[model samples]
Target: MKKRYILENSKSLLVLLVLFFSSCVFAQQNNTTPIMENQFWKNVQFGGGLGLGFGSGYTDISVAPSAIYNFNEYVALGIGAQYKYLKQKDYYASHLYGGSLIALLNPIREIQLSAELEQLRVNVNLEGSNSNSLDYWNTGLFVGAGYRSGSATIGARYNVLNDKNGIYGSAFMPFVRVYF
Candidate 1:
């Protein structure tokens, strides 16, 4: 089952990469003026989120870093990676690592819409009397809308592929995104 999931995820990622690179090639060919290869880097933006929380017997820490290439004022494509750690003193501890492919559209200056495909690997270890360990992968396909200002966007997303037993625990998530 795990192997199947990994294979499926790999195929999806490969498809996305092919499409992305093909579009880049098409755009370059359509342009009459010669564009320097380094110019591509100029339009790329890098950003992500970091979180930390600890109190009592619980702790949570997360780091996610992403980069996007702005094709124009209205469209952007990006990729991100994330890592998270969670623990409950006498309960269980978990480590999650993942990656996502995201696409953003700006219909207007104030409205932003997004679609993202995310895959995560989860590992958990149970402590105490009945000790056990589990490992699995979770995938999410999210669609979202937000209010944009400058380089920031505040939004909410719904995971169309959400599963109750998955890592996020909820199909709905709120976000504050920035790219610069």
Candidate 2:
């Protein structure tokens, strides 16, 4: 299962990379941002939100904070992190990590797409191993779609990550962004 997940994720990332690079080349040749005008953060923006994420264990509340920088109107770069607490029926688990060098594509008004490669660290404490903790690192890629209007943005994302313990995960995440 882990091997299969990695294969599928690799293919998806390759497709996203091809699309991203192709769009960038097209934009450079055209010499213009795809949308005429947008209230995009002029090179830099900050965003954060609270939500629920379910996977691995059980549903839990989460806090996600992120920052984005626009290299140009059509392409934006991002770095962000998420901390989530897992509320298992019999135990609790939490993780903290951050990522860098993500990309966003906003070729049209009111719509945006994104892709990212991220590195993560996780510490898990099962009931039996409270005295002995496990630490692991991972690589992940995610894809998302969203709509933005005024100061509010909402999106849904899907992520595939390869864990250090030879496990892989596929997660579906939905999020909201507020710009000030």
Candidate 3:
């Protein structure tokens, strides 16, 4: 009777081992790497804007360069730097240099919303008999939305913290953005 019991237990153990090995051989395999491991740099995008305006005695030239990291399809965070030179013949000339932090959201593929906080250092030099120079810092908060297509977005933004003595002429401004 003891021999029969040992034989029965051996058969059960053999069956269990076979089943386990078969399941392991037939299981799916995953070979993909995680986002943080090899995809961090792939998710970053770079873009910016260049602006120029000139008339009789007035001139404006600006260059803004920016970069953003896309957390996903819906959210992005970025930083930007801006430099602007403005001159009005025989009146005044100003140099504006600044940086901004920006946040972007895309609820869908065709629309993008953004908010940016900008801080600028302004240096103004007056021309004339009573010539004077001034230096100050200016801050602005802008909120905007745009239509997106491929790599380009066209939008308009309003500065919530606009002031009469600010660097921009108006609270409303149009923008064209491209990312790659």
Candidate 4:
């Protein structure tokens, strides 16, 4: 009985050892490597930024969020949204909603150039005045350059929002974004 017990336990231990070695080899073969294949479609990345603008009696802050579906290594297109709130003493309390189309050109592994066209709609309501709310449509053009790695990007942009009655500015905006 003692000899039989030892043989059965030894057989079980050998099977366990074989499974561990096979799993280790499989894991080594499946190690995550940076995807370098030139394919027509790749994994998509999404991110956004918060920005502030100041000029000509307007002080506004914006949250701009974006998403990109990478079609290849050299080209991608994205859709983004922006919302801005403005405060200027007491003249107007304003809200703006906008959307943009982004095009990206990658020059190297860590650098990219982007161009965006955005359209915004602004609504203005006067404080303490029972006046009708005013609304207008405005368009903006943005051009920027960026640097990126793993899951973070930093960029600088120059933007021009059309000059309308109460919502227009040109700004140099520097922003950072993170991806999960």
Clashes (backbone N, CA, C under 3 Å), per candidate, total 0, 0, 0, 0
How accurate locally is residue 141 in candidate 4, as Cα lDDT from 0 to 100? Answer: 64
Instruction: Write the residue-wise lDDT of candidate 3 on 41-141 in tens digits.
Output: 79889999999999999999999999998989999987799999999998999999988778899999999999987778899999885649989777777
Which regions of candidate 4 are displaced past 4 Å? 1-42, 51-61, 128-132, 160-168
User: What is residue 40's positional error in candidate 2, in angstroms?
Assistant: 13
Best-fitting candidate, measured by TM-score?
A: 1
1-180 per-residue lDDT for model 2 (tens digits): 674666567567657866886796567544446453343335678876787767766877767777876777577776677665655655646564645346788787688788877555667665655465566655566788899776566898777553445323436777676745
User: TM-score of the candidate numbered 2?
Assistant: 0.60
- By TM-score rank, best first, the candidates go 1, 3, 4, 2
Candidate 1 Cα deviation (angstroms), residue 155: 0.8
TM-score of each: 0.85, 0.60, 0.78, 0.60
- Which stretch of 10 consecutive residues in model 2 shows the poorest summed lDDT? 161-170
lDDT of 1: 0.88
TM-score of 3: 0.78
For all predictions, the C-alpha RMSD in Å is 3.8, 8.3, 22.9, 21.4
Question: In order, what lDDT does every prediction score?
Answer: 0.88, 0.66, 0.84, 0.70
